[model samples]
Target: MDAQLIAFTGVSAGLVAMPGADFTVVVRNALVSRRAGIACALGIGAGLLVHVALAVVGITAVLAAVPALFRALQVVGGVYVLYLGVQTLRQPHSPVGNPQGGPTARPLRQGFVTNALNPKVSVTFVSVLPQFVPAGAPALPRTLLLALIMVAVALVWFQVVALLVDRLGRWLRRPRVARGVTAVTGAALTVFGSALLAGPLRALLRAL
Candidate 1:
């Protein structure tokens, strides 16, 4: 990749890695166990792997080629983000959000899946990975390398978010604070949805 593209990807990844729901999930796991935190980090990285892999194989290209498929995905993604916004408005339980898996191998698995299945993530992976890759780069290894870079960026930033928040999680969980937190999170989700909805406007701008 060119230097500009690399820089763009770095900045974009940094923006995405900013303190948000992904950070919260990793922080939750870390407060539970350091190992779990690392595992969860890897899992979140793995979810990006899926996105990068799909981009390498031209999956999003096919989707983008078909207007219907692409628009349908955008609609679905927008609706899902709206749903997440609503869900975030609910009261968060204590650290043990779910006790059913209390004795499982590690909480990393579910945490990872939560991110992996997240519609916003799917939309992002399909959207952003292809941009930095350029048109003529070697497919597999280059894509994998970019994926690793994205993951590395995510791991460093988010693990720090986890570590820093661990010190504050107790205080942040207070009833009023948590509600405020959730409300802000909901607004962020709405912004993501709006961004996805506005994506088509990019095509019009390019056409002009």
Candidate 2:
């Protein structure tokens, strides 16, 4: 059990460290404000909890089993991410130190929506958790434990990222740098969304 736990933790850490939509969102918000960044991390943690619950309850399994439903979810998720990228690109510059810049909760919501809508997360939960569960152990308790560990790893990692980015707040807050960062992150997200949309379509076309 200990060995399994260690291996799972290592895998989870690696997954958390990989730069993806979550990383981009956290960094983007962190550049805006520490509060916003932390809020986004919390939202992402909340989103992980939702995925864990769904996976444990077998809802993710159902989604995986039904190809059409999963594909539909991917399409919606892709469109939503694309919209976010466009919104980020369109965002106007705010004066540095303006407390009224925007509601802090906005980033929190963005984090949640961005994570929850991601089909890749659902796939991760569905595919990865089962590998570490002991053959004869009570599946429910073990699964939840592993899922919670993954969530903890993700939350801790993102919090560190947010804080580290916030430490660079002085330079990043400069209008030109901020805009440049925004453009890069926004473009990355747009590309990610495009890939997500294209993957399923490409597979379908090949199948036909």
**lDDT (Cα, tens digit) per residue for candidate 2, span 60-129:** 9998898878887888888878887877778736543432235778889988988888878988988999
Lowest lDDT block of 10, candidate 1: 96-105
User: Could you tell me the TM-score of candidate 1?
Assistant: 0.61
Superposed model 2: Cα runs more than 4 Å off: 92-102, 203-208
Provide the TM-score for each candidate, comma-separated: 0.61, 0.91
lDDT of 1 by residue, 1-208 (tens): 6794578577667666665555655655554445565566767767666666666676756765686566556666555555555555453433423212233344456445545544455456556655666668765766566666776788677666656654565665566765566566567766655665576557556768
C-alpha lDDT score of every prediction, in listed order = 0.59, 0.85
Candidate 2, residue 77: how far the Cα is off, in Å = 1.2
Model 2, C-alpha of 97: deviation from truth (Å): 6.0
Backbone clash count for every predicted candidate, in the order shown: 0, 0
lDDT, candidate 1, at 29: 58
